[model samples]
Target: MNLKFLYFVIFMLCLGQNLRAQYVEKEEEEKITTLYPEAVFDSIQAKKALALGKGKITGVAFTKTAPLAPRIYADNMKIMLFPVTPYFEAWYKLRNSKENLRKRRYVYMSDAAFRYRLEAISNSVGKFTFPDMKPGKYFLTGNMSWSSTGSYNEHTGTSYGSYGTQADHYEKRYYTQNHEERLEKFVEVKTDGEIVEVKLK
Candidate 1:
């Protein structure tokens, strides 16, 4: 009976090892497939930080072309702008007064406190008109994430092990940030050439 029990334990251990190997292989294949998209879609542009100040700063402007009434209806409106280029980058300083460097916290894309742009824009300077947002202060910012489709390696096992050896390895690095500040607030029906400029807060 003892011999039979010992044999069963050995068989179960071997089965577990085989299952782990298969699962690892399946996960690796899925990871590889996910990294590459179906086709070569438009490239994602990288955004620089926005510089903040008390005075005017160069930012994209937007205007409403159609006659938007207080209680009017519209199906669609065209927005004229430049194609979004990755080279365009800007940064804004949030505070007007001098503060401790350590007290400053760098806000990232995932933060909930930061505001966001309802409509998406590809370029830096362009006219963007969307369904009229409610009359209130809104935050405008950008989010970005990037990854490299590659693998790396490092030494494994102990430096002074009985059978020291090297092994394959892989790593993933993630980077993202956010820019947020109160934008213009609108109360009445904005005219056709209502220009909204993005400036340092």
Candidate 2:
């Protein structure tokens, strides 16, 4: 192949790759403005209604977990759970005044409501909101559980059994114990808010 033509082809390939990268970046920016079904509060009235009857107007928040190294957008942030579940109770945790997390905050939703015949899962899942947050932060963390309970006496444990002769006793045991209300895994989020809108090509 001619040297000039070969160099030109190589240059074009590099150019195409660069364009693809730019396209990806542009796409990410567009996602920032995109809206989720439950996240969308198209009108002021709708926004007001959701906040109404709800205790203390705590802000809403959301995070995207997929697309590994997920792209985060301010617009993708949601103030409400898309689909509410009565099986759990959700709450927010702000930074204590003397805490190192004064600027950083968290929220949790535990499953430990026993009053209504509910045995809350041991873990609690939470969404975080930041009224004053620094930009360029990549991830957020929290935890979740399938159930929870507050009563201490309700704690339960397992029992064991044995078989065979006393001289040669073979024993077996089962783990049927339930633990006290304890926190679980910490989930990290890349974005703190909603995704911004983009100009469609």
Give per-candidate clash totals.
11, 30
Tens digits of lDDT, candidate 2, 17-57: 88777434334432122211222223343233223221221
lDDT of 1 by residue, 1-201 (tens): 599999999999999888778444334432111111122222232111121212221233333324472211111222221211222111112221134234453323212112222344424333234333322223343322222243444444334435776455444544444322222322221233243455211
- Top candidate on lDDT is 1
Using alpha carbons, what is the TM-score of model 1?
0.22
Error of 1 at 54 (Å): 30
Model 2 TM-score relative to the real fold: 0.16
Best of the candidates, TM-score: 1
TM-scores for all predictions: 0.22, 0.16
